[model samples]
Target: MPDTETPAPQLLELARSLGVATEYWDWQGEHVTVPEGTVRAVLEALGVDVSTPEAVRLSAVELDERPWRRVLPPSVVVRQGARTAVPVHLPHGTSVAAWIELEDGGRRELVQQERWVEPRVVDGGQVGEASFELPADLPLGWHRLRARVGDAEPAVAALVVTPDRLTLPASVAGRRAWGVMTQLYQVRSRRSWGVGDLADLAELASWTGGDLGADFVLVNPLHAAEPVAPMEPSPYLPTTRRFVNPLYIRVEAIDEVAYMPAAQRQLLEWQAEAVQATNGDDTIDRDGAWAAKRSALETVFRLPRSPGRQIAFERYCVEQGEGLVDFATWCALAEEHGPAWTQWPEQLHDPRSAAVAEERERLADTVELHRWMQWVVDEQLATAHRRAREAGMRLGVVHDLAVGVHPEGADVWGLGPALARGVTVGAPPDPFNQQGQDWSQPPWRPDQLAELGYAPYRDMLRTVLRHAGGIRIDHVIGLFRLWWVPAGQPPTEGTYVRYDHEALVGILALEAQRSGALVVGEDLGVVEPWVRTYLEERGVLGTSILWFERQEGGVPLRPEAWRELCLASVTTHDLPPSAGYLAGEHVDLRARLELLTRPVEQERALDEADRAQVLDAVRARGLLREGAGEQEVVEALHRYLTWAPSRLLGVALADMVGDHRTVNQPGTDEEYPNWRVPLADGSGTVLLLEDVVRSRRARSLARAVRTR
Candidate 1:
């Protein structure tokens, strides 16, 4: 049991000042108090010392003095067309001047706004707080602000100007569109080397858009993973979100590989043949496929590059700049000292250390190889997007962005203290997941993020949207706040930590607008009511899964009553595919894995009740007839989603061929083959891309969705 003693007032105040919540309402509608220990742990993660009353008091004083001590805040984010004020603190009666340096090298004078508050004495000196108003017509880009107090050194801070709101692209404006969502790695084709690659994705997009008249093809995150075997399989827990995984690169698609010497080409062909043998297996062997692919890629990597190719590779390296170098360096170092940076030598732990710099030079060739791998994947990803456009996809490919990266992965190794330590990002106990979930990934320190001007966040968004027509942010609620679980503690013992949603969302919209991409937030579970409205106000679509759309008393909401600004779907990747869900396969699997919190019989009874309600709803909506089977119910559910006024509708590919197996079972890892199951048909037979394109059942489901 947690301590029930009242927390010290100073401790609570310090926690609040650091954005840590002392209490939050749980799913059961009970006001659960966060233990003082939990609060202190979270504060310490944020670099605050609150171990004792004196420490808490000192921390609170520092928090209060921070803004006044600095000439300006670390960074200021303002929406375009809004006259924003920047606060400046200086000695009483000191004259101040401020100016803005535009992103394009232009300068503009800012006017000092009127003072609205009285001065206060701090640290034996009176400090007056003043405001300066930025030009309302400032352009949308990153700018700089320079503030000068009379005869004092000028202080500079980052200024980010964002668009008021993101708007839909011309192709999708005022139009209802539909798309197909799939686990890209599971959708194999004859040409792929075991796992589905960019070529396979392009082929699917082309066929669906050109033949089925679909507007987009949404796929799982293609984020980078470990370079060696024993790789992390879940796409949600990637090594780096900014770079594409080389595992998804179709080796033969590279032009240089096509022009390889005959002997090398033959060896590559043999390696490809060996990998392709796994294509028919029910489980995806990522390790086996990568081992073979890596060998072939090395052969190509060693070949002399043509003058044109050499110039292009150098250009890409230059464009990527220091970020690419840091990532590539981490990759090379990981290969030498193993994947976890913490286990490596202390001298190589810090990315900026002199030893690390010398290591980069010593392992220059290995670093270049990692860089080349990224370039290969980048080119193939671009080709896939181009193919989607050529095949008449309105919005083309919609990419998924995972919530966070692995704690011991490249991003953490490179990002350093920007990511919190000791505590992991997770969720408190919720209705569906009674035990709560610890994601095991570090959360970004809000203060550190602001101090760095949110460059890391912006960079991630830019990379994800590079070749995507749209992007889905998994666990989108995290943008506003994250539940922080202390190390060695259960997720239920976590507390909410608030972030500057204004700045985060503003920057998100700005990046989406600049990229001409649509944004969709996966706000399906436990989201605040205002968050949906907030996202809609910014033209970001919310996710509405069919089974979870309910009114008061748990009755399913009518399709017409669903939110218009949403991506309506019959099922999501997290849940069982529609077919298996209707048949209660998830219940049986959970029971077998011992993942059920309640008795099996009781859980089954509840699942049956839920299924019956959904069936009745479908019948009432005229989507299903009496005694409809699982296959019919699957079609009806998708058809029902089409009736929604949502701007975007998504059809899961698993439902098309009537695959009953779940793609992922959240609570279980090795007990269930998560992220390894290949796409299959109703009979549990693995289905290749060619088989899917020609399947009559797939065509039937596509027709039902398109008929609307």
Candidate 2:
């Protein structure tokens, strides 16, 4: 209909050049061809113009020639001890000299390699390519390459040397460590403002690591959400992964709060009491809590900062530089123009527009307020990390990194052009989610990322790993490739867009190595086998959920069969805890939501059979006795994990207390509460953090995996 000048074969070739997979093997082992329209839409989202045959040809030629047009690549990420050649483009007959400037202020001259190739004309000037070989003895850090071509100014590009394979910390070296995992928002304490805050996390980590003799306490992502009320409930869909959510900031924990006026303190006390009253409520109230907390925080924010505090805040602002200002400016603007920048006035849509610049000056105070909020969060997070390590935890707090940021949130608004516009990141059809999923979070344009030296991606990783001893990448497979669902299209119509894993994963490991932290990738759904091996080679652990770890004929995979480089767990957040899973709660939940492709009874029967096989395996391994109760089966399942040689064993807090509810139900938005479910025990009675610490059931489960 649209001039079909871009023929099917030509379109496929162009898509292939852009790393869009035209055909891929699904989870069902069937080859599925991606729709032509899907390819066109995906390409357009990548800023490729395929409207006309001439345009398509130009795009392809540009793709091949763009590198020749540059003096040096935007960035170069290479592993230590690996000799990689950097291509330096210059005017055909011009002479050049290149050298690497190490992060430690050292310099190394790069040796020129003989590269014989015909000169090509780019932009009416003949360009020649020269190869500079990187030394194998380069140190790991953020370095730069400087190339002086002819009489022009020297060209500079980012040159990063990442670790070849990250090694485990000495604290966790040679020993299998176990940890407790939970969604922190659901584990509210009486002291919190109707939700779990950083103070509560410190308490949870202190108790679990010191008392329970655990190595670490893993929690859900603390990524920022909208400042206003009616917040997005799912932590996985956040405003920005670069900053912490102010909602999780404990007001009383702020130092300035203690220095506030007496009358203001009294009013804050009353506000805390009002919000804490909702702690026992079945559903977690994010809107009410943030609305009240943000006001209380604002009062403390207004109090004059101590001289030392002021210096620290200013230093943070200077270190964060333009990115922080842009984010804060976007936040202030959102307060007036609304959260979605796309819906703002046309002139304000571009973050760099003159109108937005003027608006930033007009909203300077609000912008500073937002920046101050982040500084507070950073201090609180650091305190939590310090407490965890002091309590004898090997890895301290391991934070979860969500897959992507919200579509209309700060990242999309602040990051301008780095993220795709017309496509969203999602999942392909898998056994767990039959119809697939559209997460409504935009994917990064691979080309743009490489062009920008991956600054945004690196900034995100550096921030998340800043206070963490370890970080789990949600949907880690996304680093290699992501399913790109076109605008207004279902996930089934999407295609796989490949990413440069060699560079992406190398940068990830590089950041973790620099931070002295471990990396765990949630490589659970529809992952290619080679991808798992590649991750392991980089010393990044894979995630293994017991239910999904199956062997031949879909039977249970023996404990010894699980990979050692994995974080093995009996249950995950998406599914019910071990207790509820044993009772077939997941099947009943799907049936109720009408998410089943088969009859409810038939689905229940199949689930029962699967459960029986796993339980039987547990019994055969002598972890459970014959005719054991639900509690024994749950504990035994975890005890079953201990038999596996996985480096890290993850015990869910819900499974420990025999909580029967699922924290999230996939494929349903309004039909289920998803991430809003509070922590509860076996009888469906909600429990506070204080209640959980002294529970006998929890202690019993803790003992199950504490030793071998």
Candidate 3:
């Protein structure tokens, strides 16, 4: 156990300087102090040495002195169309020269805006601070700042210029648009091999956008998972945010498959058919589907690429550069050793070791195969986006970006030292999750991120936004702060860590602006009030769930009272679909799984009261009729959502088919089939894409929102 005794002031100051919270208020409204040992451990993971009082004092002094020592700070982010002053540190009375290099190879001179301040003693020398003014009209992109002081080496720092706000595209600005939200893997069609793929996504978009007059289709994260069997089912925990999972690829959709020899193609077709046999099963067989798909993909990879195809592939390789190589190499290594890189031989653990280089050479073929798989997925994603646009969707495909990457995954391994060690990202205990929740994904060290100019984060956003018309950032509060839970500690013992929201959010807005895409932040559950206001001020839409919109007396807030800058929905994946929620299936499932925090009877009573309030609200609006069944109530709820002033409204696909199962339960993993549940009706009948399009329930729900 960590020592809870009084901590030295210097220790607390050092921790604060490193962005670790020394104390925080818990959900119970009580002040809780972080253990001294926990703080030290977290600091160490952040690469700060605070093992003793002397070390803490020394670290504190270094923190104050380091910024002054550097000719220019490691990185600086300024909002576009705003003139900002950047500080420059130099020896006392020394003259400095500085210039800005734009992203397009253009250069501009910066003017020193302020006179030098009085010199201060630092490490036996006097240092002076002065301010330089940056032009207000600098283009939005990553730029460079070069500075020189006296006879010293030229110092260069990254200067990221970003937009002040993310604005909606003209195509979607003046209209109230409705869309469908779905877990793509669970929405398998008759043509899919057990698991839904990009091809199905395109088809669904075409049906909804073209036939139903929907404007967008929002799907769960398609981020990459481990390349091997026993794949991680949760899309929120990914191996790499920069790449898409090849498991979601359609085998027959690749152009090269058409040119393959007859025998090989027949074998692949047989495998696909056999895999498709599981489509009607209650749960998806991810491992089986992946194995069969992998075999077919292996065959497809053997077909020689045509000249034009080869040129495109090579261009992609060059564009991706070292990042792709590192990720592909990690995949190949996982194939040989296993998914957990920590359990591998010591020499192979370090990505830059000579042994890894030799191993990369030995496994060059496997690495290339992994790279080929990425290219295939990228092509399919582009096709899906194109299809949505062709079908007249405004914000065609709104992709989800998961919060963080898995601990033993590609990003952590490849971007070694950039990610903090021995800590996980999670949430504090709340009413919904009494024990709090810990997601075993490592977070990026704030210091390291700034040191590297947030390149990894930039690369990830750029990649995901490449073919997306909009993006939903899951747990978007993470941009401002994240709960850093020490390894081997309960989530209740975690502390909040602050991030540079200005830089982070500014970069996000810049990227969205450049991509001409909309940004919707999932700002639900225990978020600071200021964060939402900030996001709204920046034109980033927030997420609003119908059940949680309430006033002080627990009365459901009226539809018209809800925030206009939101994507309103009746339910989320974390809860049961509207049909099941109305039936109290969530309570029953929790009871069965031993997840109830109170007695089942009491819990059900409270749930009933909550349901009554929601129904009463709908009844008052005349949207619900007397003795309405779950289907009618579901439509009524959606109709209520349409009444809100929100620009974008979402209708879950599961609700359209009256699926009774929840896509995920917050605190439990193996206790329930979280992400594996197929889209099913109230009677537990599996519903495929074809059934969804033809179902009267789906069309009725669509009509409710469209007519509203």
Per-prediction TM-score to the true structure, in the order listed: 0.98, 0.97, 0.98
Instruction: Name the weakest run of 10 consecutive residues (lDDT summed) in model 3.
Output: 1-10
Candidate 3, residue 638: the lDDT equals: 93
lDDT comparing candidate 3 with the true structure? 0.90
Kindly list the per-residue Cα lDDT of model 1 for residues 235-285, writing each as its tens digit: 998999999889998999888887888988888888898889899998999
Computed on alpha carbons, the lDDT of every model, listed in order, comes to 0.89, 0.90, 0.90
Pick by lDDT: 1 or 3, better one: 3
Location of the lowest summed lDDT over 10 successive residues in candidate 2? 1-10
Assess candidate 2 and give its TM-score to the true structure.
0.97
> Candidate 2's residue-wise lDDT over 394-425, tens digit each?
99999999989999999998888899999999
Q: What's the distance in Å from true for residue 27, model 2? A: 1.6
